[model samples]
Target: MILPVISDIHGNLSALERVLEKIDSDRILCCGDIVGYYTQPNECIGKLRQLKAISVTGNHDLACVTGDVHGFNPYAKEAMDWTKKVIKDRNIEFLRNLKRKIQIKINDVNIMMVHGSPRDPISEYIFPSTSDSTLKSFLESENADILIMGHTHTPFIRKFGDKLVFNPGSIGQPRDGDSRASFACLDVPANEVKIYRIKYDIDKVVTAIGDEKLPSFLGERLYDGI
Candidate 1:
């Protein structure tokens, strides 16, 4: 089976829709932050639900449900406050129900997924610059053939001995200096994962953010992919 892995959607339905159009998979795995930083939180959640995505809770997802935006920047806090006021009850419950991490087996390959790190699933950031020793420790302790995580919004595939760790990047808001939406496809039989970047309607998302009166910087950043 081909498994599509995605994360950090951040509520941009335009980007998510475009990414979905390119994927052909029976199941989708999400690393979380399904909502935040953009408009259309409900629509985004609805789409993921339709896909029956297996998702983990993200920091923003938890913040939206619990009204705890601590450590959030001014812009993020503003967006979260608006999200809390406008998000539907059912969708908030969905976020609250998500786990911080999950594990599954596909085609005999053991995979562990989390929004952040193995240590702190919901709020940590694992960048490509992280040391090999630290990553080796995580892989050793987790005991999975493959580890998947998202939060840094940068796509990468790394290998250590026979094990692998990868990030599918952000679908809505990419920070890898690439404006395209990002995702990864795991070929279960082959035990390989490949990253994909797709162009989407950013103008539509930016316009929606303005219509919703969200922070302008949020939309501006999408253009630069910063």
Candidate 2:
């Protein structure tokens, strides 16, 4: 089966719609943060639910439903506060029930999906700059052939020994200096993984953010992909 993996949607409805339109797959694995830091929270949630995406919970998602915004930055906290007021009750319930981690089998391969690292699934960042030693440490403890994580908002596929760790980056916000929506495709039968950087109209999302009275810089970040 070919599964599309997406993460950190952060509530950009335009980007999500574009990404879904471009990809044709059997299933989608979402690494969570379906809402946060942007506009159109309700729409994004509805789309994901409609698509029936296999997903896990993220820190931002946690903050929204649990009201535990303790670790969020000022900007994220602000957006989340606004999000709390705007999303529908059913969408909040959707977030409220998301699992922290998901363990599943895809084409005979054991796979684990989390919003962050397996050890610290909701907040710890696993980035490209993460040390080899740290990756090795996680590898030693992992039981799955593939570990899918998000939170760094950077797309990367890396190997630590025989274990593979992949992040599809941010769908709503890309901090990798590319103003593009990112996602990954995992071909289980063929054992192939692909990262896709998709271009969407940033102005659509930017205009919405500005109209919602979100921080101007948040709108600007979409243009710059900062």
Candidate 3:
């Protein structure tokens, strides 16, 4: 099975649209943050629902759907508030119902998917610099041959023993100093993974944010990827 995995899509429907256009896969798996940071919360949710992807909720999704902005950063809190006001009721319910993690078996390979670390799936930031011991602990606990996650917006594939951990980065708001959409595809049968970066019209997305009156920094960061 060829599965396309995307995560950290904090709104930015245009970027998500672009990424989807480039993926030709049988299934879609999302690591969440479906709503946050940018405008078009409802539209993004609508598209995700249409695709019926297997989605795991990220911290931003929890904050926006549950109206729990207190734990979010200043800018994230603002975006959550804005998203809460604009997201449709159905979308809110969808986010609320999303799983924090999912496990599936393909071609005898145990695959675990989460928005963050397996230990604390919803909020932990797992990046390339993360210690090997930390990765080992999650791998042992999850007991999966392959682990897939996204939260740090940096894509990488790490191997520990016979286990593999992969992060597909951020689809909407990349923070790896790149203003491009990032994702990954797993050829499960072949046990091969390919990371992909696709460029989109960042200016158009920025203009949409301006027209929608979202936080200016949200629009500005798209250019710098800060």
The C-alpha lDDT values of all candidates are: 0.91, 0.88, 0.87
- Count backbone overlaps in model 3: 0
Clashing pairs in 1: none
Q: How close is candidate 3 to the true structure, as a TM-score?
A: 0.96
TM-score of each: 0.97, 0.95, 0.96
RMSD, candidate 1, Å: 0.9
Q: List the candidate numbers ranked by lDDT, top first.
A: 1, 2, 3
Q: Give the least accurate 10-residue stretch of model 3, judged by summed lDDT.
A: 64-73
- Across 82-133, the per-residue lDDT of candidate 3 in tens digits comes to 7888888888899899999899998789999999888888888888998888
Candidate 3 error regions (>4 Å): none
Q: Which window of 10 residues has the lowest lDDT sum in candidate 1? A: 185-194
Clashing pairs in 2: none
User: lDDT per residue, candidate 1, 1-226, as tens digits?
Assistant: 8899999999889999999999887699999999888888999999988889999999999999888888999998998888888899999989999999899987678899999999999888999988888788888888888899999999998888678899999999999999999999987776789999999999998898899888899999999999
* lDDT comparison, 2 vs 3, better candidate: 2
Q: How does candidate 1 fare on TM-score?
A: 0.97
Tell how far residue 120 is off in model 2, in angstroms. Answer: 0.6
Best by lDDT: 1
